[model samples]
Target: MATERPGASDGGATPQEGARTAQQIAGELRSRIDRGVYRVGQLLPTQRELGADFGVSRDSIQRAMRDLQTEGWIESRQGSGSRVIRARRIHTPKARAGQPAPISLGPLISEAFEAEEVSLDACCLTAEALTDHVGVQADRVARGEVNPRSISLRLLLPSTEPKPAFPAAADDPGDTRPYERWAAMVEFHTGRLRDRLLALQRGKFVSDVDVKVRRAPVTPTHKLYLFNGSSALHGLYVVETRAMPLSDGTEVEALDILGLQSTLFHFEKTAFERARLIHNSLVQKVK
Candidate 1:
């Protein structure tokens, strides 16, 4: 038999194999982080401990840990072991700072108007972008020319107190059906004011009209209204209350307007009309 070389018994698994092993270890650690097993700011196991756990050499574990640190999954500080740093949340173009931040409609509208050919996807994207600025766009297109100053808005409000009790089925002669009773109450309370309220809830209403309904989770009993203009958006809030013997009825607790415009450039007339109508109907009933 021929004499074998000193290291020939072991197969030729080159240095590249070691690097791959480090990559694999790094991947496993990443999975653990993703699963929340090692949360942000939590220290990871020592290289020796990790190497023992993964059945790899300490060198391999060190390489892997270094890779993770470089990738921002973890950080290493002086005298401190490797600890996870939570990945920063992604920011969209529309995110703003401060409470009641005014949404900017310029960039989106400009892009839409400047595009050479607007496709269906472009229109959809435009609508979505507009939603980020205002709740929704109007269904009907404003006639004449697109005037940034022509936009108008109104707000709808819901009654706070429970509607007054109606006559019982036995007492009423015309109709006592549950549906009829409910319809009557809704009509009495919301009928006259319904159109205006609807206009305000939906971002688009009649030509030059836009509405905004803000429901705050902190104050669940009331919904805020915003009537938008070309350069400004106004606000009003209505609250529910117990009925007293003599009351002036529900009052507008707050009213104010801030600068903000809707993204209306290059929008289809049909889409504008539809969006306005849908928004109106939905906002009318929420409060």
Candidate 2:
């Protein structure tokens, strides 16, 4: 349960009315996040800002933020502020079965940008591929081929602060060199993605643009993309042993995920994706 601040109750004429107001505020915030107003990895407007916008007291805003946090829509830290970790899923047009579903990064990205408000949420081992596609879209907007009022991009990358779950040295799992190299690669790509999106706003190509990169506690086992509040693509990362060279010229055998080679499938088509394994393996493992 989320602990509320000392005076964090929001309501109306009656006690129940106050409860409803809090729910309404939380729902509205959730809808904004669902629609990309507050994309994943983006810090939500401060409580003071929200209170002023809603014409409510700071207590009311705090109540709403607490509700949102309890529902896993946002996370708040003491001083850093509240940030969205997940974008509430909304239904979009399901991909046709006949359409080519292989990872066509560019075309899909272009299609997503056709709307006035663009929201893209991606989780991956690295932002390299997403950076490339976003750069293309940003260029298109610059050339006036495609025009969008706003663009929201949220990137989720694996956090390797204390230790990483992947890219561990195969010979010695405790080694951190492989993870360090991978983290550097992630930072470089994410930096480019942020710069590209911010450039659009800076150049007056788009009226509003937000780009956020957040670190997740776990290494990604799959790559996921959600865009335009409708479409989704997903692909699993295949972990294997590979050689990773460090900056010092020494190579380490590491268990790594080959993200570039992964193939993505439409989210709607991902049902029964692994239906072939019929053995009752649980019998052997759990009993």
lDDT agreement with native, every candidate? 0.40, 0.75
Q: What TM-scores do the predictions have? A: 0.29, 0.57
lDDT of 1 by residue, 130-169 (tens): 2322221111122211223234323232222332122113
Whole-model lDDT, candidate 1?
A: 0.40
Our tally of clashes for model 2 stands at 3
lDDT of 2 by residue, 133-216 (tens): 677677668868689999998888888775558878999966888888888888899988999899999999999998888887
Our tally of clashes for model 1 stands at 11
* Model 2 lDDT at residue 233: 78
TM-score, candidate number 1:
0.29
- What are the per-model numbers of colliding residue pairs? 11, 3
Specify the highest-lDDT model's number.
Answer: 2
